[model samples]
Target: MQTCEVETIIQAAMPEADIDVSGEECNFTVAIISERFEGQNLMQRQKGVLALFEEPLKTGRLHALTIKAFTPAQYAEMQNTFLVQLES
Candidate 1:
């Protein structure tokens, strides 16, 4: 429900991941970075995270979830691009 709680759940599922969660009570956006996603396809990567919150999703405690998953290298690249855009 809360950002920290969502973050904790993702962290539990992927202990080595770096997770950032944001949004209101029942809706959330999550960004997860980990080597575990390296060879996976996009659907697989998204499914991996969605599976962690099955119960909440089923119970409607979590209404909406938007997820972005990437490997560490991808995350770094994205961050660099964002920074460049800000400077432009």
Candidate 2:
């Protein structure tokens, strides 16, 4: 599936998420930030996103997806670090 299409599906699952999608047509990378991820461990957070595309994954319309999930606080920290790296 297309990157935007994949992004739309995941965003629908977590409306508050900040998402960036890139890569090949059927395989893509997704970075997601959402308040809904709060208090959830890595596995749980991953599962939450995976659940959103259970059907697409099963049908093979989507070949592969790499996901990075984080809560708002975590994402803020990460964003700051990224900005720091860019500035340096």
Candidate 3:
């Protein structure tokens, strides 16, 4: 349930993705950027990430997971918005 372990699992499933994970044991928030998500809808993207943690989730080893999935362009847009907010 460590962030690194969660990250590892996700990376194993999607090696090309760029992932950032935070939070403590049993609970995590993940932000993932990947081309694989380009044509997928929100739920589809979430499911694709969540599916990697099925065992941990089912066993309660991972209690809560919040996911933010995006394509590289989407992530860049989000980052730009964040920077603009910071400047304001």
TM of each candidate vs. truth: 0.90, 0.85, 0.92
RMSD of 2: 1.7
How do the residues 7-53 of candidate 3 rate in per-residue lDDT, one tens digit apiece? 99999989999999999989999999999998999999998888888
Residue 34, candidate 1: alpha-carbon lDDT: 94
Candidate 1 lDDT (Cα, whole model)?
0.93
Pairs of residues at least 3 apart in sequence or in different chains that clash in candidate 1: none
- Mark the regions of model 3 whose C-alpha exceeds 4 Å error after superposition: none
Clashing pairs in 3: none
Candidate models: Cα lDDT each: 0.93, 0.86, 0.94
- For model 1, the stretches where C-alpha displacement exceeds 4 angstroms are 86-88
lDDT of 2 by residue, 3-82 (tens): 88988998787777789999876788899888888889999988878888898889998888888988889988988999
All models, RMSD in angstroms: 1.3, 1.7, 1.2
What's the best-to-worst order under lDDT? 3, 1, 2
Query: Best-fitting candidate, measured by lDDT?
Result: 3
Which stretch of 10 consecutive residues in model 3 shows the poorest summed lDDT?
46-55
Candidate 1 lDDT over residue span 5-70, tens digit each? 999998888899988888999999998899999999999998888998999999999999999999
